[model samples]
Target: MQTPLDTLQHIFGYPSFRGEQEAIIDTLVSGEDALVLMPTGGGKSLCYQIPSLVRPGVGVVISPLIALMQDQVNALNELGVRAGFLNSTLSMEQVRETEQALLNNELDLLYVAPERLLQSRTLDLLDSAPLALFAIDEAHCVAQWGHDFRADYLRLDVLHQRFPQVPRIALTATADVRTREEIVTRLALDEARQFVAGFDRPNIQYRIQQKDNPRRQLLQFLRAEHPNQAGIVYCLSRKKVEQTAEWLCREGFNALPYHAGLPAPLRATHQSRFLREEAVIMVATIAFGMGIDKPDVRFVAHLDLPKSIEAYYQETGRAGRDGEPATALLLYGLEDVVKLRQMMSSSDGAESFKRHEQQRLTAMLGLCEVTSCRRQVLLRYFADTLEEPCGNCDTCLSPPETWDASEPVRKALSCVYRTGQRFGANHLIDVLRGSSAEKILSLGHDRLSTYGIGRDLSAEEWRSIMRQLVAAGYLDVDPEGFGGLRLTEQCRPVLRGDQPVFLRRDIKVPTARPAARRAVEEIPEADMGLWQALRACRKRLADEHGVPPYVIFHDATLRAMLEQKPLEPRQMLAISGVGDSKLERFGADFLDVIREFEYTHS
Candidate 1:
């Protein structure tokens, strides 16, 4: 039997197992169940994939998304492994063939959806087959409290009852303590070995900005910070997705919008374009792109705030998957908070569900508005402690110099009260800035004693102060009204000058430098044209096979071959990202390209 390290080198081409991958795999292969909580991009797939190959019988992988299953199967098959998936996308003939293969003991791994796995026919087949192990991908879905809960997932516990002999391994990229416990209970893996990897993705720099002309801010971020890089911009609604995509296009970006509302073909096309095209920006709602395997995503921008830190972490984890530096930018405002609260209130769950959802939303808001190091707060949410501040986040990068805003906060609160506290942040800002907006005049807010008293501060400065005031518990948004600003009981200390409020002083805006558009590292001069030709060939083959191009040959593999100019299959296998499956599947094709190139160029 090959050790996990040997399997890693022979199959996946990675030199070694990353972090706890070996430990988890050893426990599973030793015929014991395990629950693994690994961060995204932490090589979670390898833990199961390697064991599936090394273990005796066919490995049954229960996954939630059909697209994710397809991607995984295709990638596995590219490495010369016998992998198949049974999902809604497959025809009857395809399903029958896969079933026959499994029964014949000709397949190593089979990816099935939870819904399909629960079916009578499928369960019966699995019972007859010699199952090596049962792997649950995205295991957090089994928990009702998890953000992406599915009814079918709740039925997965039956797998344990039926296949008590087969070792079960559940894996998820995002799960807090509550969700983790729920997963363990729901999956009946109470005694399973628990492996919790650290949540830090040091390559991703986190940033949060108060929303001000979000589109403009996004455009500025793209143009000034990360020009011409693959990225995802998340919006809360489909309309916003479309609008943001259009705005990016108008601004000369190679961008596309993807959401469930669009036609399936269009969404697939857009997703394909993002995968194959270089530097494509995908504007999408949460419905699109989970378990996406694309690497080299340079940034993830959230135009609207995510509902929970879990969602935010998972979404941002999609970026910088290749272990490169990336950015997670969030644009948040008070309206986002109101919208989230409304969503929670309107949800059809029980009171406990509503309360939990509200707490998650509140945590997300706190992450956005917290004055401390953003990374520290985020890691602490995942039960990880950071002894020092991560100097990459916005707060850390540009440390705000705070001043006493106690009088200004009191003044703002008094003005809200004098105006009956019926106005939102914008109107309150207008009152503070003494703007004679039509609404202010109509309400006679201009005559208030606190009105115009904050003239010393700019509109932006006053808005920041107001946000801090709300965040610091001196004020609250009225839930009954249209999110009107109101003074909280905590406002008393500030009102009487008994407390000091330190506000972040706004700095002089610096001249913006044009964002550096880093070119995708080119194949060496000797093999540049040949590498492009190989990539073109790979894409054509991928299209014919109906698989993602990366499954054919990752860009990294091509670059390696170009630099080393590998002459044989064995030599090619030595390249990073080129494993046995790839070598067996596409080695001959790649070798043909290299041979032809050498002959012509010689």
Candidate 2:
């Protein structure tokens, strides 16, 4: 019997397990249960995948998305593993064949959608096989309060009830403290050993800019910072998604729109293209990218605010998944917050759910407004602490300036109060800026003592104060009053002049400046042609195999090969991602390419 480490290198090409992966695998291999909380690209699959290979029967992976299941199985097959999936995408004949494989013990791993696994026929088929273990991917879907709840996921606990002796491992890439507790309780994993990996993605640089002509800003960021890199630009709605994608295409970028409203076939086509093509930007809403396995996304840009820290973390995790340097940029403003709060208030969810949503939104706003490290604030939400500030985020890279906002805040709050506290920020800003807008004159507010009290501050500056005040809990948005500003109890001290107020001055990042090019992009001009040749070879092989190009060889692996300039088969084995299977399969082809390049150069 091979040890887990041996199986890892021989099959997966990775020389060593990452973080707690070995420990988690050991627990499951010993016929014990486990719960794994790992960030995206943290090797969560290895925790259960290696154990199934060493165990007696096939490993069953319960995935929530049909596309996710198919992608996983395709990647596994490339590793020389006999893997198959049962999902709605399969025909009746294909489903029957997969069921037969399950009973015959012919497969090392089987991927199943939650809905398909809940079928009585499938459960009965599994009863006849010697079970290895059950792996639940995206376990957060079982939590009703989570952002991506699936009713079918609730039925997953039946797997434990049916196969009492089979070990189970539940895994998720995103889960806050509350969602973690809920998954353990709802999935009946009380006894499973828990593993929580650090939520930090050091390779990703975070940047947030206050929205000003958002379309122009996004275009500038793309043209200057990301030129031809593959990325995902997330929008707040389907309409925005369509408009943004079209706009990007018009600007000569290979951009596509993806949302739930699109036809299923079209969405699938766009997703497939994104996975297979290089430098394709996917403009989409939150409905896409739940469990995408694409490894080389160069960036993730948000045109609007995300609903919560968890959602933001998960979405941004998609970038730099290959462990290469990537960027996460966000553009937000006062309207984003107001629109989000208004949507939350009008949701038909239970009152408790609405309250939780509001709290999450508040936390998100706090992240956008924080003067300190954005990474620290994000991790703290997940109950993880980073002792030092990360130099990767916007704040660490270009720290914001703070101003003594006491006098300005007092004026804003006083204006809110004097205006009956039922008016919105725009109205208050107009009043404070002494705007002679007809409404102010119509409301007879020109005669009020607080009118034009903040004339010394510019309109933009006052707007910043109001935004930060709301984020700092000094003021609250009245959902029922069309986003009116009202004071919270937390603001009493500042309002009564018992304490001073300090706020981070919004630092405007000039989008027109050229983004610093990545180090990899500085590849020697001589080697550039060879690099493209190697990629073309990989693409051809991938097309022949009917799989994503990464399945043949990840771009990182190709770069390593290119830089190392391996001339012999033995040299190929020494590459980082070259395991026994891959070296045997493509070593000769890659060596041929490298040998030709060397001969020509010499």
Candidate 3:
């Protein structure tokens, strides 16, 4: 009987369990349940993978990511774990063989779609087959009000009713206090041991800047820091995704567009290319990144605002899955806030749900406007806290200077009041900066006392003040859904000159600050050739096997090979990530590259 640690070292090539992994694995292997809330790339998969191997029967993983199951299974097979998946992508013959394998106890782990797993036929088949436990991935989908709700996932509690004795482990990367409670209620995991890991991804530098020509900003940022690296660029609309992808391609990047609007086959092809190839940038909508397993994504850039803090966290969490340095950037504007408000107001959810969403959006906006460490506010949203400011976010890296906006805010609020609160930021700015625009003259607002009083500040500066006011609850978007600015009760103190106002000075021509985590592993000039040769060997093997190069051996493993310069097969096994299966399969090729390099250098 192999222990969990033994399975981890011998199979997954990891030396020790991370964080609460060992605890979670023990609960499951002992035939108990656990609900895990670990961050992405925090080794959530191993909590179940190890228990499945150590326990007697096959572990059943229920997830909605059918498109990703094949890649996961392929990676597992490379580790010498007998893993298989049942999804629409497989033919009937293949499905039959998999079912038979499950019955014969040949598979150590099985991945099943939530819909398929809930079917009566599949349930009956599982009843007769030996099972270790059920592992539910993306467990937050159980919350009806969650950002990524799936109706099928809400009924996952059926597993408990049907298989009462089998242990169940539910896992998710993003879940708030409310969502966590809802997950416990819906999944019938009332007694399940809960493991809540910290939500911080220290390797990811959090950055949010006011939108100023987003395309140019993205291009400059990429050219400056992340050129030729794998990344995801998120757009709010399908059209924007396509346009950005095309634009990036024109700008000499290997970019592709992915959206639900695309044909399914085309989406699959683009996804495959992004996964199998290096340096591919995927321009996509929210439809693209759920359950994405790509490990080396260096950055996730948002051209627009995400709807909530959870959505932002989930989207950005996709980067740096391999625990290397990464960046999560957001470029937003006042229009983005209005658009997001309109989106919330139009949703078909219950009033309470919509209000909850609105609050979340407001918090998201606050995050963008925050003057303190972005990481602190982000973790606090998930009920986790960092006592000290994280030295990794935009604010912590380059603290913005604050201005006393006492007089400016009063004038801005008075302008909104005198104008009947029917005008948006542009009109208000026009009124403030004394524009000779037709609408202002048509409305005869050029004669008003509040008009033209703000000429002391630039239009951009006024815009920044108004944006911060809205974010801080001093101003509200028109309740009538007219996209106009209105004064809130919170502004009364400022209106009476009793409150002092402060705001961050928005950066003009903002500089690109890349992720401030540790640098990439250095390969000396002499060792660079062997490094390239090893990567080339890995790429060729990955292409032949039809899997991603990382699954062959991650970049970290390749660097270890470079640093250690392992010359013999026995020595290769001593490197981390070199298990018996991979060492047997690919060790000779890497050793051959190292030997040739050494001979040439000597």
Point to the candidate with the largest TM-score: 3
Model 3, poorest ten-residue lDDT window?
508-517
lDDT of each: 0.83, 0.88, 0.92
Tens digits of per-residue lDDT, candidate 2, 96-144, equal 8888888888999998888988999889989998789999999999989
Across 1-602, the per-residue lDDT of candidate 3 in tens digits comes to 99998888878877688899999999998899999999999999999999999999999999989889999999999989999999888899999999999999999999999999988888999998999999999999888878899999988989999999999999999999999999999999999999998899999989998988889899998998899999999999999999999999999999999999999999999999999999999999999989888889999999999999999999999999999889898999998888888888887889999899889989999899988999999999999999999999999988999989999999999999999988899999999989999999999889999889999999889889988999999998874647999889999998999999999999875564643757755678977888889999999999988899999998888888989999998889888889888988889989999999999889
lDDT of 1 at 388: 92
TM-score of each: 0.92, 0.97, 0.98
User: Which ranges in model 3 have alpha carbons more than 4 Å from their true place?
Assistant: 512-515
Q: Candidate 1 or 2, higher TM-score?
A: 2
Find the candidate with the highest lDDT and give its number.
3
Please give the distance, in angstroms, between residue 216's alpha carbon in candidate 2 and its true position after superposition.
1.6
| lDDT value for model 2 | 0.88
